[model samples]
Target: MSRVSDVYLIAHVEDDVGEAVVTGALEAAGVLGKGPGQIKQHHLLCCSTLDGKVPIVRQLEPELHVDGHSGSIDELKRFLPHLLLVREGHTSAASGQTNVGIAASLASYFGL
Candidate 1:
């Protein structure tokens, strides 16, 4: 891990997705508001579309948004001026992207 940044999660999930999201995934990401990840804010938007995250990002107004989901990157890029696409193999089903600010992994994304 590199220097901890104010991590935030703007996830899109359905209410009945089952399991931890009810109370665990965020904690595992060290996003308990006071933990290793030092997450400043987190939101679980119950929706199937990646575009659901657009409003959250707009409201937060962060300088940069990081995401690996290709479809999401495409949607978010429209609203966010800068987005870091962490390419870790698991990309969106839409297409295998060849352009974007891609990084091999979290560490690489941070230039660690």
Candidate 2:
């Protein structure tokens, strides 16, 4: 089996509604299978455009084994080493933590 690298990009939605939009985008892009407990099993890369979402992403870092998180593509691109583009939304009304899980799963699948 081949290992895949998990990569996730987060965007703030117009309101709190962005969480679903972002999640859908990630899922559509092939980032999925991240439940709650699986968070600690893989490496994660997270990118977001919302300042408010940063804290949420940060909170998930330890759980997902997050290697990097950035608010801009430039920062994420430069710092992440490997990059994956996800949907766009502003601040998730629900929770963006799942994004980290998605990233981790993808990374593990791709061996990144």
Candidate 3:
């Protein structure tokens, strides 16, 4: 987490996730650098609202945005500088100005 300028858990509420559960999961994952209070909880769109997260991603302007949604990562990578898609059976774009990568899980990706 220290490798990046900033991080936030911007998940769509309807992602079948309750805020408390999300906070607990993040806390358990040890990814909440500053703690759950620092999370930017936004409740826009459903779990599949890929583009709905664009604004938060844009505002944060992170060097990399890691997400489990392949489609969102694919599209957001076009604008964001770097992206990490955390899922199985996927690869970054072969060629593009944006930088994209893949990871099997958050623990492995961050070496947590």
Candidate 4:
């Protein structure tokens, strides 16, 4: 029988609130199962944006497996077709880690 591929939707949050949002979404998505293989997630945070969410996804040499190849989200999309943008919230000029229930709402929207 053919193997069923897993779906991955990453939620890059700004702070604790953001992390909580993502955690809730993931849990609500019905318990994450093991992927086809080990998938290492690397979160790169920057301050260029007001919310401090990095737009680029990078691969590290240290995390590379002999059978694995380096590629961006666009490249990965070729293999994993579905893409979902769950949540996106911005912090106010003076607020720290604004309440951005991004992933939670997104996962709900997608019927996760």
Q: What is the C-alpha RMSD of each candidate to the true structure, in Å?
A: 5.2, 12.1, 4.9, 13.8
Cα lDDT for residue 32, candidate 2: 47
The models' CA-based lDDT, in order, is: 0.59, 0.38, 0.62, 0.32
Error of 3 at 61 (Å): 0.7
Superposition-based RMSD of candidate 4 using all C-alpha atoms, in angstroms: 13.8
| Candidate achieving higher TM-score, 1 or 2 | 1
State every prediction's TM-score relative to the real structure. Answer: 0.63, 0.30, 0.59, 0.29
Which tens-of-lDDT digit does each residue in 13-104 have in candidate 1? 66556324643765666655454535543444344556776767778776677776767777766566567777776333223333347766
Cα displacement (angstroms), candidate 1, residue 34, comes to 2.5
List candidate 4 stretches off by more than 4 Å: 1-8, 31-56, 60-112
Query: What is candidate 4's TM-score against the reference?
Result: 0.29
Better of 1 and 4 by lDDT: 1
Question: Could you tell me which residue pairs clash in candidate 4?
Answer: 87-102
Off by over 4 Å in 3: 2-5, 15-17, 24-48, 89-98, 110-112
Q: What is the Å distance of residue 89 in model 4 from its true position?
A: 23
Quote the lDDT for 100 in model 2: 30
lDDT per residue as tens, model 2, 1-112 = 1133243434556644565666556556554445532222232233334555445444444223232343433333322333333333322121233233223334453456
